[model samples]
Target: MLDYDREAARYDATRGGDARAEAAAEAVEELLPRQARVVVDVACGTGIVTARLRRPGRRVAGIDRSAGMARMAAARLPGGVVCGDAAARLPLLDGSADAVTMIWLLHLLDQADSAAVLAQAARALRPGGRLLTTVDKNHAAYHTGGDVAALLGPVRDAHTPPQSDALDRVLGVGSGLGLTMSGRTTFAGLGQGRSPRSWREVIPKSPWGRRMDAATLAELGSRLGDLPDQDHPRPDPVYTLIALVKQD
Candidate 1:
């Protein structure tokens, strides 16, 4: 797994200012009840989503494994942010939160760990509380012809390409974890090689992005650009937002 601790400082500069990050935050916010007061953001890297959740009366706590990321999140969000692993049990009391949200975190885990984290999230939420999560839309792979090559090029420790059905299986892992598929949204960013300047801004902040240098970035741009533009399609690198309700 990529240790976000080393890249915490540059993380926001690389991703926080991007349109995709804003869209993901907006998707999470839409799923929240208008009057919802408390929320937990898991793997809340640098409070990208947590910072956006701040409102007059709402409270948002962000948790991550990287202390540096937590510090960054704390700096941006008024609510407390803590350093902790999502794969293990969460630090909060059982049934303490009104909602729990996970963003771009499911693909990082193997099947077993993914199920464990969802169960833990279910445990932490009060009965009928909401669980909002985002995962990569599997359908995008077929539409984007060069996705596999691009994946091998940049994303290191690449977990299995996420499937659309994975979230339902994850929710079904536990008996009481009844989830309602609230809705799904899609986002497509400039793929590798399409725009070097844009990719440069995004690459250095992520764990994989940190490994790429200017030269490699340029190469990616060239190679990816060489491919036909016809490959790009709506929601080429799409994501699905899942909303689940904890049942007693």
Candidate 2:
């Protein structure tokens, strides 16, 4: 994964920024219960979404592993942000949170780490509390079907773990922990859709790209370069979020 600390400064800009943040927060809010007074956002990079999650009666806190990310989050949330690892343990007390959110977090990890984060989120939720997370993240980015996806699809599928943030995978992980899927929602990734040229630059440096042989990488680059609208963004991808309710 890219160094989150180093990426902190440009994270929002490279991401969809405020527009995307608003869309995400709005979708999350739709599934979040009004009575969920205390919400903990795991891997809350820069707290952009966390800040938007706040309301008159809701208390929102953000936790991130990167010091640089936590620092930026702290600025937006004051004393409500902390530096912590979700794959290990969240700093929050067990059964204290009314809701827990893990937005855009799980796909970055292997299955074991992903399971650990889910278990931690389960451990932190009160009975009947909700855990919301993004699933099928790897697939979301490539939904703009065309030459770009055709060229990169096979490589991505081979590199991506079958259980990495898939809905079934997340449901299975949560099953043993008394968490079950209750609802789901989708939101547009506003500024995140990529162009042929962008994919050429991204695929080579991406985590999966490191596993790709030199010849394969060069071939993909050449094909992507040959595609039309090299600079035009494809249709934006829609991200899926699943809500799991802890058993009472």
Candidate 3:
């Protein structure tokens, strides 16, 4: 995956800012249990959106692997955020939280690591607690309704970065851990459309894109350059949110 520590400085500015965070927070909160007393957001980079998860009578915590990201998170969440590897174990006590979130995390990990994170998330929850995760992050451009979107299909499919089958893999991991798929919803990625250069920059930042051969990148870049709105952004994309519950 991209080096989060290095990217922490500019992370918020490029990530659609507060508008996107609000949309994500709303979707996450809606999926939470009404009685949820404590919630944790895993891989909560920058804690921009994680901060918005806070609600009256509910405590919010953030976890990340990057110290830089955690530093920013601590500013937003105070002493509530921890910098550590969740795949190994979270700093929180077992079954301490009513909800554990891995928003935009699974798609970045491979099968084994993804399973590790899922198990950890499930372990941190009380019986009947929920785990929320977002799948298919990079393919956001594919779902937009605009000319730029129409041109992105070929490029997105060719450079596929963990969008398709992400949910199935998550469900498989959850079920193996005795967690069940509880619910799902969609949220708009507000102000997230990107110009060609912005979208291209995103490629090298992803795990898959970093490994892609130079020839493939060149071909995709050429195809993208031919599309309209080379500098102007396309329509904003939407994200799918899922909720998995650890049964009591």
Provide the TM-score for each candidate, comma-separated. Answer: 0.71, 0.93, 0.87
Ranking by lDDT: 2, 3, 1
Off by over 4 Å in 3: 161-165, 196-223
Task: Kindly report which residue pairs in candidate 1 clash with one another.
Answer: 193-221, 203-209
lDDT values for all models: 0.68, 0.90, 0.82
Question: Where's the lowest-lDDT run of ten residues in candidate 2?
Answer: 155-164
Over 26-85, each residue of candidate 2 has an lDDT whose tens digit, in order, gives 889988988999999999999999999998988999999999999999999999998988
- Model 3 per-residue lDDT at 130: 94
Instruction: TM-score for candidate 2, please give it.
Output: 0.93
Kindly report which residue stretches of model 1 are placed more than 4 angstroms away from their true locations once superposed. 16-18, 137-165, 174-176, 187-236
Q: What's the TM for model 3?
A: 0.87
* Per-residue lDDT value at 37 in model 1: 84
